[model samples]
Target: MAEIVPDVGFLKNGKLKTALLQHKALSKSGLSERLFGLMFSGLVYPQIWEDPDVDMAGMELREGHSIVTIGSGGCNMLAYLSCQPASIDVVDLNPHHIALNRLKLAAFSALPNHSDVVRLLASENTRTNTKAYDNFIAPKLDAATRAYWDKRTLSGRRRISVFDRNIYRTGLLGRFIAAGHLLARLHGVDLTEMANARSLREQRQFFESHIAPLFDKPLIRWLTSRKSSLFGLGIPPQQYDELASLAAEGSIAPVLRQRLEKLACHFPLRDNYFAWQAFVRRYARPHEGQLPTYLKPEHYRQIRNNVSRVKVHHATFTELLSEKAAGTVDRYVLLDAQDWMNDRQLNDLWAEITRTAAPGARVIFRTAAEKSIIEDRLSPAIRGQWTYLAGRSQELNLQDRSAIYGGFHIYTRTA
Candidate 1:
């Protein structure tokens, strides 16, 4: 009764209007259904991409402001906890994501120390992770989440046992990253060398020398052209079309190349854990002074203390907001989910957001294209309630350490 998947149907608790079925059809296609089934079926994200540091910069959260965000890998939830929000509700359509978030919270509560937690999550030493999970985390989970990680795989080991191998390289995104590494190796590139760069200049030099040429390879060009091939980036058919439209010369390859270049070179390897996970397939070592905020040692005690302020739900963002009292939520992070909605769905979502937003409430989201249709999709009467911060959005977008998205937008409810 908790999980939700909007158009591909697996809804529970809330129901869409019968009249909106056409909008569902317009938004989700046959290919998108099959892939979305696959994407939502298993673990979709091993980490969240919309940078928390950039998001925090734009949100400028007040003391005790309630925050709502979409939980992907649950990394940013922990990051947000560091800011000492009054409460945080993280919703997702995937039940597996719900379980993962619970597991992370459980780990923070039950683990003996921060290193155990880092090793468990950073995918560094896999041998003891399952034991750690069983010993520290299992007794703390709810029945459904417990049944999820406890379910036996075909190999006769617990499903959670995958972490004991390489959880980062296991999910859809992980498999996609593995494929990219395979392709890079064939072209005589070593993605792991990205971990060694000491400066932005060295990062750029390494990328130009080692990684950038792979994009021009005919094999790579052919692979990137196949939309099915990008399921790892978690792009649905609708979002793929958005990228196609935004791409130069009507090709997604160039857009992806530019984004990958940004991921590889825009930030120092020592601080950009997103780049480390992309190229090295693991987080930077603790000694390296590079990590997501939640993973760093200095923040551990605070995250541990504030972890209880977070609650995870397997539901759509609108469903969660619709049920909340008016003027209750102040900070919202959409995490690019709006890209999947059609015009009607977009309007429906915004209607609920506008209704629930407190005065001066801020909303942040990413888009596959640099420009979004919010101006057209939403009537001026409805849209007038919020002011979009174009300058702030662009400024923060440039500083996004992850750099996978095309646009990052911030909007505030003015009245």
Candidate 2:
């Protein structure tokens, strides 16, 4: 059997345990589960509030081109569908995210109408929605997903009970965020109110006063130093260590706060839907508005049809890339997965990326350092075929949800 690393960082003695416990309480989950357990603990979805304008600005999504991407929350996958790609192949290691993506596609495909789909999935109308799930969604689900929603929690409510609950903070990252909120609250700071700020200046002032101070606490600083505390955010231990290594002083929280601060301070609150998800458990909805643009009426049919283009499995990027035919994919969205790689893994991934990418194809991903994550680490032959657009990535990166990331990179394969 392949190695399954139990996330013992949570169980490490006192200070870390307390921080983890606090985050769990705030995210609304009672306790942190093992990495695999965390994936299956709930529906585990990211609120689909991606900044589409930022994602599509520089790239040209031509019709009839196949694209391969990492299905983080599956938001970007749907967003890309709006451009009408010939196909999109989405991959992820987490089964919870896979189930959530499948459910979303099913909702788009089988729901009676656009309005019904929106009300059932986006709006808070669960009492009537269960009928929709049963009639349209339930029968279509494979056994695993059907069982996931049917399974009861300790309180005797099914996991589907989250439909009526504030599910924004329900996923693995949500739990970490919840924990961060609680730890901040322990020191007398509340982030929930930041969502109500009427102006950008007001929002900036609030983050400066409340959210920024938590990073200064010695206890929080110490806890943030360890890579394992980040598992709740879906960052494995190796990525955490790489991200921490970027800091000259070996401190990560301040650098992370700075990047996040840019997301909160520079961008308009109305456009920054990611901020809305992090601070408030919801986004602004027009009276009977449709779902996010990616899930809109126009894109639903195509995204559902393209659903088979995506395949989810438990494997690393290198393992998956090894199976691709040479010169196949046009776009690769890594999303900082390389930060988890050792030198060999990094070499293997780039070798595959180099082998699989066609001329002018783009490979985009984020990292934990301001510099390119592959500097001096990749084989010269593999690295030479690519041109990294550092400047453009820096510009689009200001819109990313996790302010904790170091940098975003877009590399184009050349002949």
lDDT on C-alpha atoms for all candidate structures? 0.81, 0.66
How big is the RMSD of model 2?
6.9
Model 1 CA lDDT for position 305: 89
Pick by TM-score: which candidate is best? Answer: 1
In model 1, the worst 10-residue window by lDDT is 12-21
lDDT of 1: 0.81
Clashing pairs in 1: none
Query: What overall lDDT, based on C-alpha atoms, would model 2 receive against the true structure?
Result: 0.66
True lDDT of residue 182, candidate 1: 90
Candidate 2 per-residue lDDT, tens place, 1-415, comes to 1221222223332222321232244342333323423343333456533355555553556666677766667677777776767666666555556666666767766777777766766665357776678788888877776777777878998766566655566777778778877887889887778766777799799889888887788888888886557766666555655666766666688776786687677756666666766776565566312345665677767766665555554345666678889988777777666765567767887888888887788877767667778989998888888888878888877656545566777788775
Q: Give the TM-score of candidate 1.
A: 0.92
Clash counts for all predictions? 0, 2
Q: After TM-score superposition, what is the CA distance of residue 238 in candidate 2 from its true location, in Å?
A: 2.4
